[model samples]
Target: MQNNYFAAAPKYQEDSSNQQTNTEEQQIGKKAVFYYKMVAKTLGQYLSIYDGKTEYKMGVVMHQPAKPDHQGGFYVYDSLDQAIFADVPLKKDGLYFAPRTVIKCACWGDKIEYPNGKIAFEYLCPVQDMGMPKGYLATKAAMKEAYQLYSEKLKLKQGAGPKSLKKPTWKN
Candidate 1:
């Protein structure tokens, strides 16, 4: 079984930038493109950084074909397979019918098989951030960098560093 992961196109909103608005289409100004790209860049970086790491668990939900054995029931594969007896297309767009499954994780989990031959597993998902990548060392590093940058901006705004704590000169 092979492991396959994919990233979908970002969902863009017309009013995301709030610069200009069209009553007919309700579209915003040109800033929306930049804003959308920024969001996509951040998300792409987060995903890439996450995939580059070794300590992660992943899962996928795919559409299976109609098999005589498992008729009507869906099929889940260890990896993406375009050719399967019980394969189902994921999207409804074109006639290709490629399965529109979501690989929920970047790694595998403990293998558990059911009596009915169905397989189940758990992925390496951190508890923080509500089952997403949180508490990972790399994630922590990324967050630390972001925090440092924000802290620097805050210092510039306040005209003082983060250490400038206003301790009461005279105790109450």
Candidate 2:
């Protein structure tokens, strides 16, 4: 456990230019309509599923019944089924509904050389919304923070965890 703790040292140098570019990109807004929505309470767990080998991030969103035995018939649950809906985290806000607990979307990319040649590859992050009872909003925020922290852990020390398999080519 002690050995697993994040290193106290800083990782890669912070590129102000890259940071500015990311800020611009985020301002662009959502480009697609997600089909899921969560209540902002039932958010249960936030995980960063990594394939150690591939380093692909999978965002999962999961939801369960609001309660058991206490059936609120002829209502939303009755219509939506025992399973509730959770929105994708990468949306304007976590407001949609879905059956899963994770949402994996492209976050960033890197350049690498494949065994055969070279290419550019990218990876995405995962978001999970639990939509708990009355803590939907609060839980959602906490989950987001959890994910953010998970990401920071990776940034704690760069070039040591996972490297991309893509290679970039600049043409004149």
Best by TM-score: 1
Task: Name the regions of candidate 2 deviating beyond 4 angstroms.
Answer: 1-138, 159-172
Each prediction's whole-model lDDT (CA): 0.28, 0.29
TM-score of each model, in listed order: 0.20, 0.18
> Mind giving the per-residue lDDT tens digits that candidate 1 earns over 65-150?
33343342222234222112222223233222211112222222233433433333332221111222233222334556888988
lDDT of 2 by residue, 110-153 (tens): 22323322122222232333334443333345668877877766
Q: Per-prediction RMSD in angstroms? A: 20.8, 27.3
- Poorest 10 consecutive residues by lDDT, candidate 1: 32-41
